[model samples]
Target: MSLTLSLQRSLQQTPARTATIFGTRRRSFREHGDRVARLAAALRSQGLQANDRVGILAHNSDRFLECIMGVWWAGGVLNPVNIRWSVPEIVYSLDDCDTRILIVDKAFAALAPRIGATARHAPLFVYADDGAAPPGMLSFEDLMEQHEPVEDAGRSGNDLACIMYTGGTTGHPKGVMQSHMNLWSAATMRLSETPILRGSTSLHVVPLFHIAGLGRVVMQSIAGECQAVLPGFDAGAVLEIIERERITDTVMVPTMIQAVLNHPDFDQRDLSSWRRLGYGASPSASVMVEQAVQKLPNVELSHAYGLTEACPVISSSGPAHHSEDARKSGLSRSAGHPAFGVLVRIVDAGGREVPRGVVGEITARGPNIMLGYWNKPEETAKALRDGWLFTGDGGYLDADGNLFIVDRIKDMIVSGGENIYSAEVENAIAQHPAVAMCAVIGIPHEKWGEAVHAVVVCKPGAELDEEAVRTHCRERIAGYKCPKTVAFRDALPLSSAGKILKRDLREPFWAHRGSA
Candidate 1:
């Protein structure tokens, strides 16, 4: 079914129930359904064609949800822009995807001029806000404010739904084309993986541009749950909302998690309503996960493993496993079993099956798999060959069929011809009490072809120096894998999804040095 149907089904069954709570704007299922129907009709009038891309350059807001359903209703696809992207990056995405309609919220209205100028290629532009629209722009409210409810766009199953653009870390970012059914399948199945997100009031703290954020919206809608949105993530602001709204579930990356945990009022806050802490985009540190369980007591920690290409979910580590084996390390280290209705395989370089416990590329195949990259046929073939999505990640399955992500073979650093997995080095570096976060990458070396370089963030009040961190790694990992050079930073670069952008972190240093 189309994700739009999820909302329609919910609204039809529970018209009086709250569909979404947008701060002061309470939208009951009946209210939202009428507006969604109207907006869909209006968009159809504006000439939106089936499978056309409609870009939303907004943060979390009621209009964002409205646009999502409206686009599907109008027989178009939603291309939610990453709110954190620079204006130029936004331009690239809208242009690359050939978006016909651009939706801008008040927060990014000022940027509309530049974005509009660059997006002259688009056919239409609309501004969304409770207030007035910028000059030369159409009003989002007017389009839906008075129109009548209409029929569904009738696009579902393999019909294109959304094109989530990845952060352009390597070269230009490519769009991962997800179909309506592909995402819906991932969403409904995810409830089985993360039950707390079902029939619960969720907060969109993560940027809507990401798979995690968008997937949550569809899943919650299917379960007929209420969603409350925050424009963007702010630690103190999040804590205040959690307490005030009695938020039951939300997904966050490790950085956001750390920010909230370190908030001065964290311990004293009455955040007892939170039911689930869904974390992904990167591995959650064992210490932080353990501490959160002890401190929150009420919240469950669940981990998901996937990429944009997999419609973003392949496996999940939930609270049941957390209670059984995570007090120490065994299950905590695993990224849970393959997700429901999903198949995972670890294969060697030759595409042959590898024995359990031997690290190999983790590949997946299922209904949730993305069709292909928007226009990169070669890369698409490389990724989706043999009916399996070959994720570049390196890991292995255990005797009990639990997967343990040992390292990223694609992200491996080679120094003096010796291979080093960044996760291995980062894990050891995280052990140092003075370190907050770290990223290890291969830097150009005149003789060794490439050398290990460390980019690190130190804990507040800690004075750990570069040499000291090098010594720590040297003592734990292979001596050659230790950083030959270290750069200290207050924070590392992260993608909107909260994964460390190693490509972004490595670009400047290697701009003129090597092909890294």
Candidate 2:
């Protein structure tokens, strides 16, 4: 079913029920529906057509949710830009996907001019905050005020729904094209296995740009539940909202979960309303998992494993896998079994299935798999082979079919729930004049799950320091993607073909620890 159908269903069945809550502002299903319809009309007035790409660069808010539904209702494809990206990176995504309209929240309003100047298509900007619109931009509130509610476009099935830009292995971003069917299938599969009770309140702490966060929004909409949103994740704020909203369910990365557990007010807050806590985007250390189980005995712990290409979920491990007995059997560490309606396999380099218990490249196939990468035919073909999406991850399955992730074949570093491509970081570092060669790897981190570490060889007689390399990288990439530590190396380990052997760089940090 189309995503718009979810809102329609809620409006018909629970029109008077709360639909969104942000700070003191609240909207019922009826009010939300009217606003979404008006937003669609506003979009159409700006020449938005069927399948047009629309971008939103903003923090989590009720308005962001409105933009999502409004875009779809306007028959436009959703292009949720990464909020952490650098200006150039953001421009690349907008240009790459030809997003014609961009919705900017107050936090990102200052960057609109730079983005407009750099982006090839030069998107029309819509200020989505409560304040007055800046010059050359249309006020989001004004648009809704001026336009009349419009009809749904009724697009469904394989129609392109989203073009989510993910970090590429080649020093750029690639747009993952997800169809309406892909998102609906993934959401339904997740809900079928772990159903949401009607009227249950879900707290949205994660950023709306990520697939996990965005997918949960869709799932909540389909379930016709109230969603309490936070502008961003803050340990104290999250706890306060959970108690105030009487939130029943929420999802976060392991890093976020750890932050909440460590918050001084975590125990003082009235958190009895919480029932389910979902964590993923990176593997959880056994110690952390045990702590969560002991500290939140009444709460159900769920783990999901997937990438953007799978519409972000290939498998999930529910509370059963987080039990004490399961932890003793080491099953708690597993990524869990293949999700319902999804088929997963462990394969060798030749694409042949490997024996059980052997680590190999993970592959998945399902109705929820992404349509393909936008504007990259060769890359898309490489990823999707013979109807199977090759997930660049090393994993194994036990005889009982428990999936365990061992390593990241793509050398991707997930820090604070954000994917940082080594190639992208390396390219940024190599541009520094003093750097002759560089390699980036994810080292063990106590707080962020994995820290981006860089190994660099300076030009002969040239000088550089850790901070210098980090500062240089910061100017080019996001602050989080910059190397937390930089080691000056005489040379990076190289293979016979002169390719940098990153395994050697990661060996020292991960020698006694499990792969993150």
The reply for model 1, stretches above 4 Å from the true place, is 196-199
Q: Which stretches of candidate 2 lie over 4 Å from their true place?
A: 412-516
Among these predicted structures, which one has the highest TM-score? 1
Q: Write the per-residue lDDT of candidate 1 for residues 157-198, one digit (tens) a residue.
A: 899999999876567888899998789888877877555445
* Candidate 2 lDDT trough over 10 residues, lowest sum: 492-501
lDDT digits (tens) for residues 95-200 of candidate 2 = 8988899999888999999998888878999999987999989999999999999999988999999999885435588899999999999999999999996669
Cα misplacement distance, residue 491 of candidate 2 (Å): 26
Question: How many angstroms is residue 184 displaced in model 1 relative to the true structure, after the best TM-score fit?
Answer: 1.2
Residue 200 of model 2 has an lDDT of 92
On lDDT, the candidate that comes out on top is: 2
Candidate models: Cα lDDT each: 0.82, 0.87
